[model samples]
Target: MAKATRWRNFTRSEAFSGYVLVSPTAIYAVLLLAAPLATIVAFSFFKDGYLTVIREFTLQNYVDTWSDPVFRAILLRSLFVSGMVTLTTVLIAFPIAYYISFNVSRSMKSRWLFLITIPFWTSYLIRVFLWKVILGYNGVINSTLDIVGLIDQPLNMLNNVQAIVVTLAHAYAPFAILPIFVALEKIDRALLEAGQDLGESRLMTFWRVTLPLAMPGVVAAVLIVFIPTIGDYVTPQLIGGGKVPMVANLIQARMLDLDNKPMGSAIAVSAMAIVTLVSLLFLFLNRRFLRVQK
Candidate 1:
């Protein structure tokens, strides 16, 4: 009777209720995410064989992965492309978000948000292909230029890093905009009025107050864009025309085309490690900034 009463009391407690609520999600994450990640990590350490993983543990995959100059170049290119995409996306997103957050009335914000999300309703693949058509030789831009007598022949615009960046920035614009809009919306109106009342210029007030508070959203947008774009296979493969292979392309070639699963896994693991380190570094800096602000 006493034990039953104690158990009932424990179950009714706030902490127990919280754990119970979270248990399903925790279990789901362990099964879906943790299990697959562990398998990949295991595969990275094993030897590669024809159509099968060799039973022997070996570091040859890592050695080969690190020793190759091509892999290094691809890795650097992936990082550069992702960084550019993140920067461009954030820079473009901030103004649109600011307009919606500050200039638009509260009653119309939902409609504007819906408009912002309209692009997401379409297929991502279709968007990429559309950009390909736009940038291709003899395509819309080139034909327009030719008709306008701006050039004697079509300009070669497709299948390059710039094209890839442009496509990715367009694709990820919504992701960057939404978070920043949320951050901006959360800012107290009184704070702005306070700055103005203190005799600060509008630009000075924004520089000193608004941007600092919005750093969290900016960081979130950066991570959201950078991490996935770095490992993207489709944009670089299609838009880049295989001339500029990112890390994901290399991993795909290794695992599928080259029949080297272990090496691919090693490369994948290494990429995950780098991404984790970068994420942690960003989080640390964000925390430090918050502490200093406080």
Candidate 2:
């Protein structure tokens, strides 16, 4: 009876409730995320051959991955492409977010949000293919240009880095917009009024007050777009015509085509490290900016 009473009391406690609330997520992360990551890390230290992995430990995977010029070039290009996509997405998203948050009536906001999310209803691969059709030689753009007599031949728009960036930017626009809208909606209206009362113009008020308050959402949008884009194989493969290969494509080739799991794991680990470092740097800068604002 005493043990039962103590157990019941403990279960009723706030700390116990907190643990119960978080236990599901903790278990899910351990099972789904951490376990796979640990396996990949372990794989990175082993020797791999065609269709086989040796149990022997080696750092040669990492050494070879870094030393190869092709890998180095592809890694750098992947970072550049991801950065461009993030920038383009955020720039395009901000105006739409600002308008939706500030200009739209509350009753219509839901409808606006739904419209923004309409693209999600379609398959991602379908969207990529649609962009290919629009940009391809003798496709929509070229046909239109030809009809207008603007160009004598197809503009060579498809199968390039620019096409990949544009497609990715469009795909990630909704992700960027929602966070920024949330951030903008949370800003105190009184602050904007105060700025105006102090004789600031609308543009000045926005520059001094609105943009700073919205930085957190903008940062979130950047990370959301950048990380996955760096590892994206589909867009580059389909749009880049094998002319532009990102790190993820290289990893896939190593793992499947060459049957070298160790090299693929090493590349994946290195890419993760780079992304982690960049994310941490952005967070650190954001924190410092917040402190200075305070």
Off by over 4 Å in 2: 1-8, 291-294
- How would you encode candidate 2's per-residue C-alpha lDDT over 200-294 as one tens digit per residue? 99998997799889998999999999999999988999989878999999999999988889999999999999999988998899888877766
Clashes of 2: 0
1-294 per-residue lDDT for model 1 (tens digits): 999999999999998989999999999999999999898889999998889999689998899989999888888888889989999999999999999999999899999999999999999999999998999986899999999899998988878999999999999999999999999999988998899999999998887788888887888898999899999989998888988899999999999998988899999998888888888997899888877766
Residue pairs whose backbone atoms clash in candidate 1: none
- Give the TM-score (vs. native) of candidate 1: 0.93
Candidate 2 has an lDDT of: 0.93
Global local distance difference test of model 1: 0.91
Q: Which candidate number would show the highest lDDT if scored against the true structure?
A: 2
- Candidate lDDT (C-alpha), each: 0.91, 0.93
